[model samples]
Target: MGTWDSLHKQHVDVFIRINLLEKALLGLLQNRATGDMKGAASLQKDFLKAFEQGMILHFAVEEEALFPVLARAGEKPRILISELLAEHKSIMEKHNMIVQTAAVDKDKILLELIRELADHAKKEEQSIPSIISQLTPEQLNNIDQDAKRLGYRL
Candidate 1:
């Protein structure tokens, strides 16, 4: 697959994963409210695992494949890449907070994180692929290779 295609597929995967996470977070909230501590903890474990593997790795792959190229692009693209990078950092911080927080506090933070991610995804879907489309074929091939090397199977 070409760079844009691989990245697009990954974006779709992340979106689906986000939807699943929303469901899991909602379940966690319901569990906590009903005094089902065991259930809540179990769901928390699952959510954490998925978030780390799915979202964190997705961010890593994007950084590896796109950031350097975007950095070399024109002024507007450079600025936009910085914003995306900042969002990734913010999301990671929130993920860390969710890990350390109490159950009662966790759901609220998770909800915020989910909403932030949903918005972030929308931003990327609007911008990144078009920037990527401007790359040469060789550059596109290299990006796909880099993403695969980083363990993002297309």
Candidate 2:
């Protein structure tokens, strides 16, 4: 496959994986809100781990490799990419807050985090594909390597 095509596939795959993680977290939140403490606790642990591994790594890859390529391509995407980065920061803050507040009413905090992450993921999925399409083969290979260095395969 061409470099851009391979990168596009990677982007789409990451989007799908993130969406799945968001859905899983949302389901956990729903279960928590319904008073399923045991179920909520179980899902909360898994969700937290996934957020750390999947979401954080995904953002790291984008910030380290993808966004720079988009920014260098043209000014048109800079603003949107900046906004996405800000949203990533916000999501990270919320994730950290939820982790910190877990000792007191962990379920409620986790539910809030899940909602915030889901909304952020939706925005990212909408914007990232277009940005990915603009990258060159060299850029994609750089991104792939950066992600690999960060311990993320995709």
Using TM-score, give the best candidate's number.
1
TM-score of candidate 1 on Cα atoms, chains taken together: 0.78
Query: Clashing residue pairs, candidate 1?
Result: none
RMSD of each: 3.2, 4.3
Off by over 4 Å in 1: 20-45, 101-103
Per-model tally of clashing residue pairs = 0, 0
Residue-by-residue lDDT tens digits, candidate 2, 82-120: 887887787787787877764665555655665665566
lDDT of 1: 0.76
The global Cα lDDT (0 to 1) of model 2 is: 0.65
Worst 10 residues of 1 by lDDT: 32-41
Instruction: Please report the TM-score between candidate 2 and the true structure.
Output: 0.71
- Which 10 consecutive residues of model 2 have the lowest summed lDDT? 1-10
List candidate 2 stretches off by more than 4 Å. Answer: 1-35, 101-105
